[model samples]
Target: MKRLILHITVIAITFVSLGTYSQNNAFKGYTIEGDSVVFTFDVRDYSKFTQEYTGQVLDFTDFEIENVVVSGEFNLWSRDHWKMNRVNEHLYQLKKSLQDFDDEFSYEFKFVINNAYWAEPSKEDPNITKAAKNGRKIRDVYNLKMYTAFPKKDGNVHFKLKGYHDARKVVLAGSFNKWHESLFKMKKTKEGWELTLQMKPNIYQYRFIVDGHWMEDPHNTNKTPNEYGEYNSVVDIKEYTAFKLRGYTNAEKVILAGSFNNWNEHEFVMRKMDYGWKYVVPLSGGKHHYKFIVDGEWIVDPNNEVKEYDGNGHINSVCMVK
Candidate 1:
């Protein structure tokens, strides 16, 4: 009888060991190999992809993850364009093909998990690196993780100025090419004046000089005011994050105040649109806290629900800078 009981106990222990091994061997749903970053979502490990609130795990399955996307500086940080594919039962995958931009390229990226939460690299992840400012490791730029198929080529930017036909000459000046006034001279065209410049991928703040007067590009809607209270036409030749707010058309002015611009309320005034306000600002990867000042009233973003306490008895809207 004792031998029979011992045999039953041994059998139970063997089954338990096999069950634990099976659970542990499940696919983790993500892998970074060579120049490619791959994500494999497996339903068996669904609990592992969830966010932890306090001590409880907030399972993402409850929200019914409709989609997943990977975005970063490489794609100009578009919010919802790169969608992943579901391969099979409880399995989804996204394989990002990288390009080589010549130099030691580094870029920050994030996973738009379930089209709702912007998931950062796990703290325990071996690839995660420490970042400056905040203790958050999400800002760490992945160095050459994704290699481009071809080398980066120079882009041609054509500058045009209208109604400047009467002027003797027009020069292009900005951060690009060292703001040289005499270097880029515009040729007169039937419509106005134009100049084509071959430049690398970058953001440039420029103005057209007609005769002796320096003026912003009237045709371009994007502009940034300088310290001297002058507006400079802004041009983005690379990827950048765009911010938008809606339902404040009646407000006299709406300004984008955030940690990126040192919380300068007047520096980044947003342009009014038919539905609301819009502005495109270049920001590095990581986390950013911001608020909108609509006609002097500081308010959190009505559209963005992600927020955190500002310690001053105010709630600031939070955003991931990927």
Candidate 2:
């Protein structure tokens, strides 16, 4: 009788240990640390997918989940880029860093299990799911909203478009508003049309749609070509780096050309001040090579001490930003 009781106790202990192991291997949700976002998945939840469709008890214990990967818009929806790591017996995780990403960009991602099964978030809970759908083969069906980084500041910058007197309607479109043409309408002013947008310290590409005619900002010379081969006015709504070139006061036109603006000769025209020609441009935190275009002659910054060869036999002024 004592041996019979000992056998029963051993069987109970085995079941309890299995139950605890299964519970420990369950998904514990995602984690966010600074610019990194971590996604976690549990292989045990794979049965949920079969149960949802067949309405029957499906055991996934025998099914082998070999690999898991993350595919998303940030990586251009590449299937083989971000492979998840198996943390425990059933738990898998993938951590992605968005430190180099823009201030605010929307992205969508889904997990691929065994390189064949595509798992997505369930409607009930976004953090935990075992739902796999075939419709997700179409990349546009992604429904996850992920933010890369937070904005630095909440400040309103005034954007003005001048000399469009005959325009009946004007709209401001750019990266901030997802380049929506008719989203932010500009108010008509005596000088032209103006709009105040709450913006953070970042570089933005924008254009004015005056009476349905897309045009670059006439007053702002900073412009860049968009994906459509059309020019869009670029604005840096942040702290300015005063690029001054002394002894260029007598020049007809002084332009600020730099790696920041893709070496565009006519993009940034400098103002002829009393001492020299000055151009205040919003430069992000990095090192940049620049030159001054004084009457079509490229010249390095006279005031700047740091200089580097531009691989084209010409020395360029190097500006370092903290």
Candidate 3:
């Protein structure tokens, strides 16, 4: 009996580990795993560390760092707080949840050395941007960027405008940046003008400013009328979200039905796993009501706590794609 119990515990542990790995995605500098974000800092990237607390300077080759902490707007720029986990002699890591940050914005941060020095990144780094305080920019202080992981995507989104090759300047503006006129400058390409952004999945309305003239995307037909009587082109970014129904391993089959697909019962057949059943579907941004049909019986998601009354005397699970 003891041996059998041990075997059961091992199987449970294996399924839990597999579930975790399937949900998390890691990239350079940071990783977005479900609602958690992990940030990595490598001391090898810095040439020198200037200690403000002790007025000491240490070179990368000859010095020792006793501790490392992360300071940024998230912690109100408090140095010596938020210590990182030391992975090796040269690497450090920190993890935080998506609840700790505001959605859809980039946070400026820097690594601290031994609770004293501020580690600065090279200005040429793409993720390095200037620091600001009280509405004024702090010149010469460069910081690293951390973004909220919602509306997640694995890659960059490309925006292009054709037939404007002769234009002097082109800018990409929309709800992403509150329609800032000159923030997102598009480069002139052989075909036209183009710009790429690391945007999260959501519906965004955008327009092109060609030589100071605001115009919608001519190549795209998905547009809506604006308050100015003109039209704005729309783009709906979507990401694959996995839904899993745990337990009920004896069930013959499971089907995934959601409002995104008009709640068709037979459309999405879930793949059976050791722990349960799983299905991955690309869904657009916003709230979606879904349920699982198990062996021809309708049921709400067992693991999800967010559910709503459909007003038809039935409760349905809700998934919000931010």
Highest lDDT against the true fold, candidate: 3
Give the worst 10-residue stretch by lDDT in candidate 3. 1-10
By TM-score, is 2 or 3 better? 3
Predicted candidate 3 versus true structure: per-residue lDDT over 283-306, tens digit per residue: 766789999999999999989999
lDDT of each: 0.56, 0.60, 0.69
lDDT of 3 at 239: 62
Q: Tell me model 1's lDDT, rounded to 2 decimals.
A: 0.56
* Candidate 1 per-residue C-alpha lDDT over 39-96 given as tens digits, one digit per residue, 9 for 90 to 100: 5545554343423122223555555667777655556555577777888767777775
| Pairs that collide, model 3 | 151-201
167-239 per-residue lDDT for model 2 (tens digits): 8999877777566556578878787776654443456677878888887765566678877887887765444
Candidate that beats the other on lDDT, 1 or 3, i.e. the better one: 3
Checking candidate 1 for backbone clashes, the offending pairs are 98-147, 98-148, 99-147, 99-148, 100-148
TM-score computed on alpha carbons, candidate 2: 0.37
Clashing residue pairs for model 2: none
How many clashes (backbone N, Cα, C below 3 Å) per candidate?
5, 0, 1
TM-score of each: 0.33, 0.37, 0.59
Q: Which ten residues in a row have the lowest lDDT in candidate 2?
A: 12-21
Report per-prediction Cα RMSD to one decimal: 25.2, 21.2, 11.8
Give lDDT: candidate 3, residue 281: 87
